[model samples]
Target chain A: MGELRLMKGNEALAEAAVRAGSDGYFGYPITPQSEVIEYLMAEKPFERTGMVVLQAESEVAAINMLYGGGGTGKKVMTSSSSPGISLMQEGLSYMAGAEIPCIVANIVRGGPGLGDIQPAQSDYFQSVKGGGHGDYRLPVLAPASVQEMSDFVPISYDLAFKYRTPVLIVSDGLIGQMMEKVELFDQMPRITDKEINEKYPWATNGKPKGKERRILTSLDLDPHKLEKHNFHLQDKYKQIEANEVRYELIDCDDAEYIIVAYGSSSRISQKAIQLARAEGIKVGILRLITLWPFPKKPIDELVIKGIKGFLAVEMSAGQMVEDVKLTVRERTKVEHFGRYGGVIHSPEEVLEALKTKIIGG
Target chain B: MSEIAIQDIIKPENLVYEKTKLMTDKTLSYCPGCGHGTTHRLIMEVIEELGQENETIGVAPVGCSVLAYEFMNVDMQEAAHGRAPAVATAIKRLWPKKVVFTYQGDGDLAAIGTAETIHACNRGEQIVIVFINNGIYGMTGGQMAPTTLPGMKTATSPYGRDIATMGNPLKITELVAQLPGTYYVTRHSVHTAAAARKAKRAIKKAFQNQLDGKPGLSFVEVVSNCNSGWKMEPVQSNIWMEENMFPYYELGDIKVDGKLLSK
Candidate 1:
């Protein structure tokens, strides 16, 4: 029981960043996520926790700032919406290649290009798949509630530093704008410069007295060396997949049908599950906490237990359904349901979708 | 002539010059006679001379100097094409006490990275920006760059640059000097011994300003020649640059202590 407060998802995240002992935050304002930087600016985290907050010229500059700060073995973060995150792809790729540790929170909006400033879980492909060019995958954490939004900040930093890789927290307008009770974590002191040198010897802070100079760059012009680096990155992704898969199974023990979802969709499906059970349908919800490591093992276990079908609910046209299908592999039928283009689906709509698309279909 | 002993010539008192220890033993990837090597040496020398060798972090930009991290050797990070300034901005802001600088070329500093460069300078980021203006994109086989002079020929401008179609060459040093955030802005050349000395002095001053906790960004632009990119001999390229490039780009201080110098 740390301090409790009613805070918007974006505000909670900003407060959590300060409490997480973040050294710096560089971000550009975007709809549904602008509150993040606005809150940080108004709160004056620099005075309270020595966290440096800057409003960058653009999302492009913001992500590069993360690269620079994170390369120095500092815990830094940034938040943006869809279009802004798209502008950040190149920097993110470079950071991924260079193995810099940082965190990015994408408060998703409807988009192919400037779609709308409403809730949408449409970036599934971009988040799980490599949004940026090159062969790299960022660890994607999908926070379904405002509480998870606040809690995921420290978890993201921990995973980022542990793997020496970028981590992403994907939420949306619903969670970002909605106010909810959040139990805030206690403030952790920012790591001292000496501690950073000791912990991250490879960081590009400065050359220690007699130590070898450090160089952090993604460019290895030699084909063999680049290939070797790629192999090393792949090995890291494999380890993350093996150990970091996270999900929550609700009322899944006696489920005949399961609704697979994450983020806001998972929250909606929880309500839909309750409705379906009231109507004598044995449906359960599978809420993914980590979108990247996809939680295939749990899905496999459900399939082995004779679950008939899966309905992948989302706020997109149908993205995560692909992953669910790939994991189910025709052993069971998997279908997709959603109201896209910034439309929010109701619990009744989800229940109808499950009955029509999976149970009855 | 008397035979000189190797030991005598290499003696401590007899040695007039030696490579700065700040630079690593790694071989530079720059082409023969490229000004990048000279500029790299000058920056490292300044850092070493200031006793800030272990207290500095450098952001290396893309282009011929993308491999600058391999040679200069202090803790360094390689930035994307034109984002060195943005990268350097975060480093300096996070660790205000640490000496931070960005090494960028014309294409990186003036063209693709113009927004980052301008905004960083405008925001008065407390860092040094070492801009290398070589007129053409040397790393990508002589492509037309933002700083490419009118009528100059490059791989992309095989028939000579058409000013109306290609746009006028950007005088970025002059452009940045107009910004209030810049504490010191200067333009120099490194083609001759005297020019190299002046350029070295400018670099040292820029680094010293950051160490002194100056209020704004320090910019040092070094107009250099790319002989291989220009498809000319090293000597011919230097001579051509003096005749054609110097009159347009000019030389000497453009701004000092946040005040623009009058023509």
Candidate 2:
């Protein structure tokens, strides 16, 4: 344990980035996540750890900056809300195709188009299922607490560098704005250019003598070459699925019904599970941590053990429910219940929907 | 007669010039007689002359020069259409001591990437922007560009450019020169040997400005000719560009030392 501090989730994340030894941060301010850049600016990470922080002209410029800095094998990241995040899809797709390792946080707001500033999980499909043009996937992480919000920064960057892929923290405004106690980790020293050359030999850090120059690009005009590149990307994704699936089971053993949720919805479902158990109804919750390489194996195992049914709780109208149904494959009942357009469901509402639609049905 | 020894006739001092080592062994992908080749050679030669090859990072834009990384022997990042300036800005900021520049064409710089270009210029980022204006899009076929001359016919402007509906050509270099954050801005050409030498000097000054720790951007716009896009013979395209494009986009220094030159 390094230091215990009570801080807002967004501030903790920005501090966590400094501690994680990030090389650069470029972002545009938007509601519900503006504290990220604010904290970085206030802290002056440049003086502390020599970190580079820039307020970009727009979200479009910010993401492209990530492309340039990340191409040089620097650990870079940015945060934005719904509309700003939508502006980043083009750059994200290019980064994914070029296999640049960087982190992005979407403090998701309600949106089909600038719906509201309040917390909503409507971007589930956009983050997990290729939001950009080409066929590429971003490893998405959901932090259920302010502590997890701080913890996921370093973890996501580690996974990003491990796979040479972009990682997303698909958070919501509730977690971003809420304050909680976080035991921050020890500071990590920034990677030197010499070390970067040793570690990421292929990085475009002005080529070394006797080595071939590196060009970070996603454009391959030849049809066969592009196809092969796509195939290689798919293989990497499949490997990620095989190796990295994370979830937490809250009182799941010997349960008759289960609730599937993540982020703030998972917190609500935990309360709902406790209330259901008090009434002599055997219910539990599976809190998904990694939303992209979803915890399908655990769900499949639970299905084999004959769970009665599942209620997918979310702040959106049944986005992740499709993935839940795809995993269950008709072995058990899978239903969805949620709020929409910046509306959050209460624990009582979630329990009532579970009793009426899933368990009682 | 006794055969003169070839080695004695061809001495080391007899050599006039050689290709710069800053250009790589990879053959250029540009079309034959394309101005991109000349422009690429000039920039690389400038980098070589300044001894910044190992310290330089280039951002290559979309359009015909997108494969500049293949020919330029330096670390590079290929940017999306019109995003090169933004990318170069990031790189320069992160490595403030390194030499960084963006190579963009008319469509990439003047049209799609106008916001990035303007903001970067306005911010006074210490980077060079090499803008190649040929009055048409070359990579994606002969389409009307943001710098397309009025009354010029192109793929999209089959009946000749109608300024009433299709808007007049944009003089982007002049627009960028008005920004306070630009240290040097100039327009040059490469049709003749004298013009090519002048263009090379301009590019060298742009890079040297960065080394001198100048506090603003240096933009060098090279008025080029796209023969295939213009649907003319290579020589004829040169003649047409000199007759038409040169008159509209008159070459010379537009700004010097952060001051716009008087017309």
Question: Residue B66 of candidate 1: its Cα lDDT?
Answer: 89
Candidate 1, residue B162: CA error in Å?
Answer: 0.7
For residues A73-149, could you state the per-residue lDDT of candidate 2 as single tens digits? 99999999989999999999999999999999999999789789999999999999999999999899999999999
Over B164-199, each residue of candidate 2 has an lDDT whose tens digit, in order, gives 999999999999899999999999999788999999
The residue pairs in collision within model 1 are none
True contacts kept of 2: 0.69
lDDT of 1 by residue, A1-361 (tens): 8999999999999999999999999999999999999999999999998899999999999999999999999999999999999999999999999999999999999988999999999998999998999999999999988899999999999999999999999999999999999999999999999899889998998899988999999999899999999999999999999989999999999999999999898998888898899989999999999999889999999999999999999999999999999999999989999889888889999999888888789
For candidate 2, the docking band is medium
DockQ of each: 0.92, 0.77
User: Weakest 10 consecutive residues, lDDT, candidate 1 chain B?
Assistant: B6-15
Instruction: Write candidate 1's Cα lDDT for B1-263 as tens digits.
Output: 99988877787887799999988898888877778899999999999999998899999999999889989979999999999999999999999999999999999999999999999999999999999998999999999999999999999999999999999999999999999999999998888889999999999999999999888999999999999999998999999999999999999898898888889
i-RMSD per candidate, Å: 0.5, 0.9
